[model samples]
Target: MMQNTALMPGSRWKDPAFWMLAPATLFILLVFVYPFVDGLILSFRPMNGGGALANYITFFTDPHLWKTIGTTMSLALPATLINVGIAVPLAYRLRHKTRYQKIATTIMTIPLTLGTVLIAQGMLSYFGPNGWFSQLVQALHLYDGPVRLTHNYWGVLISLVISGFPFVFLLVLSYITGIDPGLPRAAATLGANPYRQFRHIIFPLLLPGLAMSFCLSFVQAFSVFPSAVLLGSPAGPTRVISIAAYEAAFENYDYSMASAIAMIMGVVQLGVVVVVLGARRLAYRGPVTGGKG
Candidate 1:
């Protein structure tokens, strides 16, 4: 048998593959790791000169600060669920080549190009009390009173849905398309109906991708700032954790407190991600065959 020199302890460092990872490792260190470590350290140095945990104590003690976590989760979870729920069926239907596939994809993806601020401004113009939506509702006599959609919780929720759907849809669409079409076709041939084929053959394979999509969408919705400020009552019902961190950093000029709050925000996001990924482990992990299994 030939000896594997590349596996040798001292010779591994001379491998080209090891050098190929240098740029990415350096980039990650500079872009993600360094900032996170620095912020974590900064969070300990409270401006008021208390213990290392002073900022965390203040955050937990104050209702105004701690309540933002619940508020953010309320918005993030529902928005993520709606996006993923809708995207699954839609992506399934659009997995195969169709006449309207490109057109539909282009229309759906248009929202991704629009910024959060622009979407918020548009909602205010179109969904405001006296705007087109309310006017149309009144014209059609859908409701007796003014249709209040903007500057409230509903407005923020709508913004999140509109912006987040495209992302989830695209991710799910890719995952669905990557599945072996013959698997579903084989199920169909074996007397399985459409719903049965989907549930038994397709969904198990797609669960991992869906979990990842949900985590990403939840993170995007959780960190919402401009929409809450522009379209919702930031001081009251729609106040998210990001707003609290912003106030601590900019308004109160408490970098340490802001860093602490950011850390908390990261922790909550990480918890949700961990739960989702853990659940994904129970899903199917078979090979993704290209119809040749």
Candidate 2:
């Protein structure tokens, strides 16, 4: 008797679509899952051959190591806020097609192409103590002394902004444009001014995207190492968590400690992401777009 192929066990595996996921699955397993598991295991293995918790305990007990969290947060939070704050309004303004929109976007994207180290170098030249900005200030008699911008907190902060703002802007712009133009127009027809329309409609729809953008920007800023070392005082003000992790792995040749620090960093970042994503649920849960199918 002939059996039905459709009813055969494991028939679904024969389909091409089922096999199509193989590459991505293999990639994730090799690249992400394997590394994460390996790192997690390594974090528990201390170099001094102590207890499983030795790495974590040492990280917490050492004031110098623990303090990197606060330093990273100080820089990350402000930079994320500044980038999102600026991107939102600017994105809202540029959402609709305009003559200068392309030009503006091109200019904004220039920074993204320039990596962190290049941006730090450029900032050092432009915003350095005796750089053009300081020279211009002096030429205009704006200040008696040279303007100090690099090798400090402000230097790192500025570098973060320059590198981060483009990402935030593009992400926010995509969300804003996805919104139906009719929503704002309808609000306008109802006697709502531009401000009121945006307040009632645009801003509400943008919150979810804003939260995501903030999380991403914060992560980028938090992982700052090149900028902190090149632009800011790495040994003091800009000694971020990445620097601690780097020192552990490369400088001190302690892979276990580095993995532990990395795990902690991931946990902190995950916490912020979870909180922001949770808060997003409180916003409008309807379709992101105003248009109907």
Candidate 3:
């Protein structure tokens, strides 16, 4: 057999794939990994030349500052759940083709094309207390006055859902389609009901993808800054961790403290992602036996 081109000692250097990957590796090192390491080191530098942990101490010692963790989690988790929940059923229904599929997909994906800032601006104009959504609700006597939807926690929550749903839906739909369509049909032929077919044949295979979608959408929500500022009470209910880092860096001009806050934000996001991925271990993957069927 010919020696493996990728593994051969001297010839490996001539491999086209190695050269193709080199630029991407260098870009990641320079653009992503380097900044991360620099920020991590800066986080250790105390505000007044003390130990690295001093900023961390200040972070945890202050109840008001620390409480932002709870605030951020409250928003991120719910938004993620809502997006995943809606996406799963919608994706399942859309797995098979229909004439309206393309149109529906394009509509749902509109938010992806629009930036968060644009969406925030739209929410302010359309969903604010005196805007169309509120005015319509008031017109129908749904409330005593124009309902408060923006410049608060609810606004940020809505913003996250609008921005995150398409991403989750697209991912889940792709996963759903990847499953052998014949499997579900076979289960149906065997007299399995819709719910049973899903629980036994579909859900297991989709678990990994759903877990990944949840982690990605949660990270997106966790990093909320513009929506929190424009469509939320940044000083109050919706003061997410990104805002804290922003204030520490730009407003206060304290890079060390800012870096520490940034690090904390990353740690919190990582913890949530780990917990979600860990929960995937409990899901059924497939049959244990060899492929005898």
Off by over 4 Å in 1: 1-3, 7-14, 283-293
The superposed Cα distance between candidate 1 and the true structure at residue 219, in angstroms, equals: 0.9
Model 2 per-residue lDDT tens digits across residues 1-293: 99887678998788787688888899999999999999999999999988999999999999999999999999999999999999988988898788777887898889999899889999999999989999999999989999998999999999999999999999998888888888889989889999998887888787877888999999898899999999999899889999999999999999999999999999999999998888888766666544521
CA lDDT, candidate 2, residue 189: 86
> What digit string (tens of lDDT, one per residue) describes model 3 on residues 1-293?
77676677777679888889999999999999999999999989977876879899999998877888999999999999999999999899888878566776888888999989999999999999889998898889989977899988899999999988999999898888788878878989999999998888778888888899999999999998999999999999998888889999999888999999899999999999999899888654666122112
The C-alpha RMSD in Å for every predicted model, in order, reads 2.1, 2.4, 2.4
lDDT (Cα atoms) of all candidates against the true structure: 0.92, 0.90, 0.88
Candidate 3 wrongly placed segments (more than 4 Å): 1-9, 288-293
Question: Each prediction's TM-score against the native?
Answer: 0.94, 0.94, 0.94
Q: What lDDT score is found at residue 184 in candidate 1?
A: 89
Steric collisions counted per model: 0, 0, 0
